[model samples]
Target: MTAVEPAGLAAFLAEHPPFEALGPEALDEIAHDAHVERFDDAALIHDGFKEPTDEVFVVVAGQVAVLWNDSRQASSDPDDILGPGDVFGFRAMLTGRSLGPRAVACGAATVARIPASLAGPAFATRSGARFLVETMVPDRRATDVPSYSSVDDLIEREPLLVDPDTTVGEVARWMTDRGVPAVVDLGGGRFGLITDAVLRARVLVDGRSASTPAREIMDTTAPVVHLDDTAAEALMLLLERDAEFLLVTDRAGVLRGVVCPRDFAISPITVGVSLHEQLRRATSIEELATFAGRVPPMLGDLLSRGLGAGRVIAVYSGFLDTIIRRAIGLVFARHPELSVDAFTWLSLGSNGRREAVLSSDVDSAVAFDDAVDAETVPAYRAAFAEVSGVLATAGLSADGHGTTAQAAMFSRTNADWRAAARQWLAAPADHNGAMMTSLLVDGRPIHGDPGLPAVSRVFNDLREHPGTMRLLLRESLAYRAKLRSAWFPARRQETFDIKTHGLLPVVNVARWAALSVGSAVLPTTERLRAASGSAMLPADSAATLIEVFDVLQRLRLRYQIRQYGAGEQPTDVVTLKWLSPLDRSVIAQAVREISAVQRRMDNVSNYVAVEEWASPGRA
Candidate 1:
């Protein structure tokens, strides 16, 4: 009988999974017998041409590149590299195959090469060995992981593929049948894509030949996603390539699957009725609020689904609008005196964009009928206050500062609202006017009445005041973007609070653009396009602003989800430590761009000072 001598190897294997899951005695025996090997970059550790090794190679350091073929027909990136504690090189050993795909190191790396004589028999009998084979085998497939993990992750998928000989008619039919909207032309391995929209407009609408080969009209360079690509990576590809369909392919460049625009499409706020149903089912306001809390998770998932960030805001706002109306309905049903057909429910700021985060305070207002006397107005105000309080009971924080639905100014007649709008526009063109202008610019009628035209006139009034617009831009320029602390000691990772550093700068810049045009639309994207028409925002700034906002929102949404899962609601107050390495870089770029915009605004506003922020400090 041989005695097992295990110490250093046992400690290392014990730290890794599956091996870690193994019983101490088994792990000790396996570790003691494991062979140590080292290889250089692109060095084939194992190949199909050779007999299978009996043991799995557990990566100890550096990187491993698992090649699908020995001929180097295709390759994987270092970004897809696997590291310490990761297991590889056991497939042929498991299947008893004499030949298998080549294996290479991404660089000079050390691995624990377990011999097959001991591993094969142990794997046949030991649970840990079986688990390792099962887990690592599946992980080797590129499709096993999601291309993008979070909403902020860029969307990257390979272009759809088809034979070049395939007819446009057949390609169109295939796209429609598969509901994929696009198909790539594939002969050997590489491909081109033809989108459904393109087929319709270019072939059907343009009266092109149905018999035409798809290769004729197919886009040669469509977006592509590596199996291991993150959501942020995918988005970057989409942005860089300006392509819609993203193909998902394995490390060998062989097509594994695909993701189209619709794969990431987010539905609008139609989920509100179901939420109302859930709310109605609850017996108490607290229960209703708890149910309402479910909305954020749904929104988070939708945002993850590739819903445009602006539309994400719209969808969230839509539900908020529904909840508010539903609350009013519930109030009217219980108290008849609360009934009034003349009031308009308005949302301010983020709510106006329909993009409120999970932990958001509901900022709103109610404009009442003008025919009512002062005595009647008091009663109406009281009734509306009760309604606002009811919303507070249901997870929404009331604007306790009385700037929103709680304020009488918000609950006024059309005439009254018009008068206030005039006052805001008429106010001295300074910080006071800037604040009022900011709120009013974003104020969109969320519920009740078709009086939006009257409200839009306020922006129209402001447009005539160049002084006011300049003042707004001046106020916007008052704050510099936040930076990480410069004095942090070495060894700490440096990251920025994306919300404060990345988002606010864009928000302020976009606000200036929207206010410059008196564009009442609250969405950054929408206002950006609109602001472009009037040259309110520079064309370069407009484009960068959209991308910056998209990145920030996605990061914020994912962070919110992480917090929510940990029994914490999401907040705008983000700490730098929460961001990913990719995100932190993107955020830094956005902040610098924003600062440039602020500098430009400085020239326009004559304001030299802005808010001070820390430099990128060590985390």
Candidate 2:
């Protein structure tokens, strides 16, 4: 027996699966304990039920055959063949099963033997453990659904429509006769949707006559979806706009049938129509609270049904937004003096990015018109307070960092917001400034003015300052501590906080890249897409980040759902024991990729800084 050179062994291990996933420190540990051995052709490396199985073997240079003694046919055929980078002999050890497989060298073979003590900690690097599990059970793959891939698949028939000259009474009569709740207005080369709610709010509630023109009350700004667009795209449009109907058109711009929430409500897990209808009909905070309680169960259902994490979060965020809007509407009804048009309510953080999980709190702010007088500010504050109380009752707490609309700091006029933005930009490294920039960078107006010009202005102004980008990058790096080193040992007693260690770092990176490129997009995936398209980040890097983000989010959601079902308060921490070996492996790969992306970003930033210093006037 000969001890292998640690450096050579480390290099060999770094090129293989599971070991390749380990950090340098873990590889060093393996290199320290590993020993090299050579076997002659037809020599038995291990005999079934006789030889000790405490050591895991990795083929270095030649092939070895793993033969099961229980079955004569298997002995003849061999269960598996191990070549360079292949590992073996750990399954029986981990599971406390008898050594049933015998390994034989096919020819002159070199192998590295790692003690169970060293090989055991390698499982802490999820990729290593997952590889073992996968080798043991090859049939356990993620289930696939026969989902509708395109919006055109959801199109059933042509939409009901009327000419511009049609009277409201006639349109109402036609809607009733056709058993439809809405109709498309294809008049004057424009596409519009006239819904029952629109008719009631604009015509009936406003005391307009039924004989008035339907076109006058129709919603002209209905979101449009292309025929080739995926069902997810159509659903996103409906959810984002809070629109009941989406006008579907072909690439030629010809009118296709309309898509309602019901059309895309094929997933029993999402139940989009049922949830939206209930939210729309709810008239009070208490009523909305009842619906809010359904979200956790719905999330559980979605994950159980194998829905993608991106879709689950988007659907949940949309539902949560609907609840928020309905609750706001109820407040407005109670306090008519508080004008909705005067203030824009922005959802910050996860809600802003539309990436909220079940455990998320309400992170929001209010931006008011400059015309709002000092006397009216208190009234607006009171209204926001009431809204926050309702949301709190409905299960969403005011953000722990104090970014909610309940605070006077977050509730400010457009002029005040701009001033705050400038001040924060000046000290981006400060705790409060970093927190504010992270939140406001993803601020999306959920209620009132959808355009959110004031919030947009703040982000645009921050992006204009190169120093702001530098500080943002620094802020993002602050969370780099969450990333686990390859050599870090896994904990058995404590659970890992996935939200903190997994999701936020990716979110912050995407946010910085997006803002540096002047992209005002909110969602993490969209931000990466925009940044990649603008060449602020490499396309491959952006794509990898997106994939890793998706993996982290999915694991987070699934873990939370399981915790919630166990009568526990759903928290961000996930017990590693609860995860399948495959899931753990996937998560490890994702985390490593994220760290790599961060390093790439650091390199790019440093290079740019050097170039700028060398050529001070160059763009």
Candidate 3:
């Protein structure tokens, strides 16, 4: 559908409440970018469960019916109905979810589809903010994370299903023939999985006859994932469950297909099949390093997909985590005597929060069992040395704060971690206690165990203790963006510390809200959006801060991508003149939103950290 005359579209949009608040330029941009489409009475405008929408629709003629239950319905039975000048699909754009009040044409309807790229200014409008505040629902998730592709999209072929009595040799032959995942049919809709590894382990290693029943050797406890689950979610599920592959099933428990990490090529980062497989199969540190060079292109592709900044950050951080994990595995493979089961590798700071950027430092820590004494410590250190070398070669920088395993303070026994957590929570104002506490609060298990219970307990203590949380909040206030008019300029050749001013404030406050409310969710966007009705942060402020966070993240990521492409160190410094006028304007608005939140925080507490720099400059 090609775009027609913009004058009519612009006029139609101007009558809508949110678009009415947008200026003529913004409205015209949307109009110019829009393509008109006509739908029949029952045509689906959007599928509410697949992925978020990239475009919003405005009804121009006839009627559009909304089905909040996400099921198609007759025009008369719709949850809500809209006529000419009515808008739909903006909520999906804002929330980045397909939780739709599904739209269906009540009759022959004409609608203008405006892509987010063009209608962004409308999303930044005051009326737009008000609309979100009023209509926005506090969305909770099973995991506080994000994704791009689903398991259904990854399933390459149908599963090779064999009867329960089928011999191991027969199953092996079938698997070899189809190159598809093999499953044993156990009747009653239950399934057991078999693989080449299963054949080797059960039949060969155990010296069992190839005539044994496939069902007996099949893995009955094989992991499973829903067809709708994002590839990122499936990847994490695989790690958490220590499963080789997952049985992709529909809602009714029917096995649709089977998927593995290799099948999940499109994580938030677009690590295609070849690159992901290369990372998995690489035997040398140098090879892993070479493959790491290819990932920036994946990151660039992810940004090109128009996913939310938080999702992009999560994807980038996930890629780093997998690289580090693979590097660890490779190092350990050379040393068969070393057992890595008793230890956990953790990601800290921004990476831990799943909010990392291109140039994020390697903020990592290790927690090991106390049983590994002086004798075993040397071996662990030698192995970590190789891990660090691989990481550096892979372009990950060591943390300036010495938060890596190279630092004595960070690499400690599980018992020692518990003790440190107690100290930080007891006297958070002490030397580097605040910093350590914040890192621990944001710490995520990258490899090994999902988490070290000792480290997790530290966060539990922090959450239970309000005084410590308030102290952390006060410390967060130290990170401020300069929003004053005197220091601000439009389209100037100056750099803005987007991380400090634009990002950190929102990140910090959201952290405060998460901790204060005792919600353990990571990701700044999740924290802010989840803090919906709290008095300190009202629904509107939370919504506003979310928008601000997204804008800052978009600018910072685009800037870093440009810098990375130029073969320079990727930094969070966003150059104003390099940005489009709209981007620069959004940054200004985001800064003001952050400032407003900071002002509210000021009224919430007068107690400040003892550090001189942590003190505030009056707003």
Provide the overall lDDT of each model, using Cα atoms, as 2-decimal numbers: 0.60, 0.71, 0.72
Model 2 lowest lDDT segment of ten: 136-145
lDDT per residue (tens digit) for residues 1-619 in model 3: 4345799788888888678977798888888878898888889877655657878788888899876554343345776788887777765665566666677788888888889777655654434533443333222211122435567877778888889899988888889899765888776668999987788998999999879998789999788888875565466556445576788888677888987644432233223323554665578888899998888777776656545556667667767877888889988888888887867888888898877888788888888877767577667867887888788898888787677875677778889889888888888888688888777777888777675647656665554566776788778888886654543455254767888777877888887777665677888877876666665667787888888787678778878888888888888777667888788788877777788788877775654332211222422
Candidate 3 all-Cα RMSD: 20.8
Q: What are the root-mean-square deviations of the candidates from the true structure over C-alphas? A: 18.7, 24.8, 20.8
Cα-lDDT of candidate 3? 0.72
Poorest 10 consecutive residues of model 1 by lDDT?
610-619
- Show model 2 residue runs off by greater than 4 Å: 1-150, 156-220, 225-245, 249-270, 304-306, 426-431, 461-463, 481-493, 533-536, 610-619
Q: Residue by residue across 91-172, what tens digits does model 2's lDDT show?
A: 5454345544578899888888888777765643435423432353211111122332467776776677787768888888
Best by lDDT: 3
- What's the CA error at residue 460 for candidate 3, in Å? 2.1
Clashing pairs in 2: 23-486
How does model 1 fare in lDDT?
0.60
Best-performing candidate as measured by TM-score:
2
RMSD of 2: 24.8
Off by over 4 Å in 3: 1-271, 305-309, 333-337, 484-493, 606-619
